[model samples]
Structure formats: C-alpha cells, structure tokens
Target: MSEATDYSRETENLDNCDVEAAYARWAPIYDLTFTAVFRPGRRALTAAANKADGPILDVGVGTGLELPMFEPHTEVYGVDLSEHMLRRAAQRVERERLSHVVGLYKMDASRMAFPDAAFACVCAPFVLTVVPEPEAMLDELARVVRPGGEIILVNHVSRKDDPLAALDTWLDRHVAPKLGWRPQFPWSIIGDWIDQRSDMELMERRLLAPFGLFTMSRIRRLPLSQDVDAPVMPAELEYA
Candidate 1:
C-alpha cells in the first residue's frame, strides 16, 4: 500500500479497536516487561491508598500489580477495559490471597457503573493517556469519589522542552497504534481540564523515577457547596 494509504488504515484501526484488544496481547507479559519501569509509581499509589480514608477504586488496574501492596484492611475495587488483563489480575488476587481486593470488574473507565460518591478514593495509574476519553474518565472518577475524597493519578506527561520530546512525538504518532500507548501525550490536556473545575483541589504533583518522565498527582474533591465559577487558566499557563 502507498504510505498515505497505510497511515490512513492504521489510524482507522486505532479508532475502531477498543483498548482491550491491544491489552489482551500485552497481558501475559506485561508484568515482566513493565514491572521495573513502573515500580515507583505503583509504590506511590500504594502509599496513597494506605493513607486514604475508606474504600478505594483503582481504575485501569492492569494485572493488579498494586493490589497486593494496599493495606490488608483497606477494601479495594479495581476496573479495567481488558478482560485478559483482568484475568491476570484475578489470578494474582487469588494467588496472593489478597482479600483487600474486593472486586475486579471489566468495565470502561469513561462510563463507570458506580453511583455518586461510591468510593473514598479513586486512582488511575499509568492510565490517563491510554483511555479514549480521559476527560470523561476523570469526570466519572470525580463523580464516584466522595466530596472530600482523594483522586490519584500516575502517568507520563510529555514536556516540550525535553531533549527526547521530538522523538517521543514521532513514536507516539507512528508506533503507538502497535504499542498500545500514547508516548507523547501532553500534560496540558489534563492540566487545562482541571483548571476549569471548581470541585477539586490540587494537592501535589511530583515526578517519579526513571528520568522523571512520569508524574504522580493528588487531587482532593471539594464539597458541592464549595463549587464556584472559576476563571480558566491562561493557555500559556495551562502546562506550566
């Protein structure tokens, strides 16, 4: 096929395929390959979960790597779009006898079935960029988490000034379809979205290990009474 036609076909496939199919292929060897690189973020998430008040919701809980790390007394629920990944997670839960893991459902993060304020904390680890609609997923997370609850995210955010930025962008555009991740996704997308909301408070943003490509963010949901009309951050400041 011509180069343009090949590119068009690839884009079409990416749009049509659900994340599950991509992850299904990766599930079997995911832990072996990514466990080391993602260790710091997973540890941070576990620490956050241990300190959180009530039940926890782990969105995009691929292979349940962090499930066993949660405190034994903390009740944890996990959801993911990939059944194959969830199956691996289920096996881990059983093998480890991690009773703290209350559930592992195969569900889309953009439209979680849970009711409002269903959880005390909602976390998405290395997940934001992988979803089809990250804004919708965040909104759903906010809806399910209690007013005073925490929302944690651990993901890689592209930096325009980074030396690897150009290469990352090229890889994201050319290789992400086969690799199942958007390596060049910008932090501005989430930052801009969050800046317009009045319902959450930004608690922290810290870089993780492995060259600081990844970051961990903590946000606390404000009570309904605190909701207010706030001015959006300036375009230049959105990614700052």
Candidate 2:
C-alpha cells in the first residue's frame, strides 16, 4: 500500500478495533484497574448533576460508574459507543436498583440520537480523547442540551511544562497502541476549539487532586441570539 493508503487503513483498523475491543477486554478488570483513577472526576460530575435541574445525560458512561452517585430523584440517561460497556452499565443499574437511571443506550457520541435540547446537563468524563472526533462530539452535546444548560468535562489535559510531560509523551507514542487511548492528547486543540465557539462560555476550571493530572470544567451554553457571531473553525487544529 502507498504510505497515504497505509495510514488510512491503519487508522480505520484502529478505530474499528481499538475502542470496543479494548473496552471489552478491559471490562472485566476495568473497575479494579481504573476506578481509582476515574473516581474523582465521576464524583465531580455526579455532584454537578445533583444540582442541575431537569434531566441529565452522561456521555461515555462506561460501566455506569457514576450512575449510583446521582441523586435518587435526578432523572439520568447514559450513552456509550461500546456495547460491552453499555451492557455492563445496564447490569449495574439493575444490580443497584438505581431508579434514577432513566435509560442506557449504545450510541455514538459524535452523532447522538437524542432530540434537540433534550438534557439540562451533559457530562463527559474521561472521554474526549477516546472519541474519533472530539469536536463533532462537542457539537452533538451542544445540540442536545438546552440553552443555558451546563456541560461538564473531566479529562486529562496535556501540559508541555508539566514535569511528567515527557513520560506522558513517551506513553502516548508507545503504550497507547496497546492501551487504546491517547495519553498525551493535545489540550491546546480542545481549548482553542472551545474558545472559538460563541455558544459556549467557560464558567470554571479546576485541577483535580493527587498531582493535577486531570481537569474539571464547567461551561454553560448561551442562549441563541441573532447578534452572536457565526462560529468559525480554528485553522490550526483539525477535527479527528
């Protein structure tokens, strides 16, 4: 194959095999291996959900880890791209008798089936880097959430100045192939994308504990206005 074709095929194979297969293999040991790493973000997301009004959507709700944390009265829905993960999430709902969990679906975050303005709050935890097209997924989230709705994100952001930056880069280059995640995902690209959008207003940003490896952000979707500037894509970053 030509170099371009080879790269394309490799990317296709990675997309088809990486996410679902990796999660399927990890499903059995996921809680044991990742629960501690993800717990802080899950806690922050659920805390935000408890305070938000109306129904909430948990995007990338892997194994329903945050499902039980939601208040019993809050109506919550969850969606994940991996059927194996969604099945586990469904089982958790049943095992825990979580009455607040409205539904779980196998759905792509980039092209969600939800109707417009369906949720009051959208939470994406440790998911942005996993998706094939993070920008498209963010647009889908914006579309499904009501005006003035909150969007909460908790994910690891790469910092070039961090002491562990070199280690993170090395892992992204070497270990990511086996682990199936981009450990050194570019935070600058995501930041620039969010900054260019007129509809999204950054409300708060805080570094999560235990070495500040992750960041939690609270952003509000502004109500549509005629005066709002048309969203212009940043030329420096390509959606992937």
Candidate 3:
C-alpha cells in the first residue's frame, strides 16, 4: 500500500486567504442562510456544555447563533475573527436578553487573549475549516481549557469510505476552499492532531442529524503532573 496523503495540504489553501473578510461579508446574511441547517448541532453542543460546571468559551461565534442555547446559569464568553459578525452577536444578546453570555471579544482564535487554562470548556461550532492555521487554533483551545475540561467542535469532516469521497475530493481541491470552508475536510486534519497530543484525548465523536453531514467531537484535556496555574480572569479582558 502507498503512504496515505495528508489532505490538510491536499487543497489549494484558498479559503485561508481572507477568512475574516469572508465572514464579514457573510455576517449580513449568515443567520438567514444557516440558522435552520445549523440549529441541531448548536443544540447538541450547547446541551453538552450545559451539563458541565464552570465557564465556557465559544470560538468563532458568528452572529452568536448559539448564544441563547446555553442555559441561563452557564457563563459563556465568546470570541470571533469577524467584527461584523460579533457586532450582530452583541445585538442578539441584548435583544434576546441572554444574560448568561458573560462577554464577547473580537480576537483571533489562533492567538487568544485569555490566560492559560482559563475555561472549563471551549466550543467551536463549524470553525476548524475557516481559520488559516487549524493547528494553531487547536493549540489555543487546549491552552485555555482547564485540565479534564472539554474542547468541543462541530465540523464537516471527509472520510475515505464516504460515498461522496470522489466528489468531496474534487470540490476540496477545486471548489470548497474558495467558499471559505473546507467542506471536504479530511478527518486526519483532526484525528491525527488528537493522536499526537498527550494532553488531549478524543472522548466522543458522533454524527449530527439530517444525515451524517456534520460531525461533533468532544476532546478531554488530560491533567498533567505539572498543571497550569489556576484559571484567572484577566482584569482587562473580562467585561462587566
């Protein structure tokens, strides 16, 4: 058998060019275009986060579609690459009276502003594909989450055994990246990342409804003999 291809480099990398700008453009109509289709995944991830104690971080929180899904007691902070999208999220918070939403910050996921192990969990909904460097963002996710806490994600992952493997591959190279997301994203981009990490472990992987088009993964952060200092709120970072 031949060596397996690393599909992270299999595509043109076109989508990585202007993710923030692309999402800024999408902000105006993002909810209208995706709210219905993405609702189930939002519910699934938020419900799981709700069960855990302590604070939660919502990365790539576009237009804050999932903000209201959290239980009122769940203290949630949000971050996004798109200021345009985050503006809409602020409006949604006030309009919907989502008080559990602790704060919303305009920042890069790859280089977050929070302290190490600052959260109980981190949830990235349909986000891994949009960033220029997914591995860097994963590093930040692992950094901010407390040991034994979870890093949850929902993404469109492509598999070799998929019935549409041929079409997915064609689109990934020719079309998907241009659309600002790697719809035909290879599982190794994620699976291999998990395998190489000693601090993280795949706790759960499941397919979302309306067909197995989206995958939701939950990764647990293993406690080390030398854990980070206790999570603390940066005085300047936390909003009143």
In model 3, pairs of residues that clash are none
lDDT of 3 by residue, 1-240 (tens): 011111122234444446765777788999999999988899899998997679999998889999999999899988886777888888898889889987888777887778998999999999998787888889989999998899999987876667777887777688654566765677788889988887788989999964777889999998764234445567899898
lDDT by residue (tens digit), candidate 2, 162-212: 788998889888877567677887767567767888788888888886588
- Is 1 or 2 the stronger prediction by lDDT? 1
Question: Candidate 1's residue-wise lDDT over 1-240, tens digit each?
Answer: 000000011223343265667798899899999999999999997898789889999998989899888999899989887767887888888888888988887677877778899999999999998886778888989899998899999999888777789888898878776777777778777787788778888889898988887989898898665666545566888764
The TM-score measured for candidate 2 stands at 0.86
Q: Could you tell me every candidate's TM-score relative to the true structure?
A: 0.87, 0.86, 0.84
lDDT of 1: 0.82
Once fitted onto the true fold, the runs of candidate 2 whose alpha carbons sit more than 4 angstroms away are: 1-16, 225-240
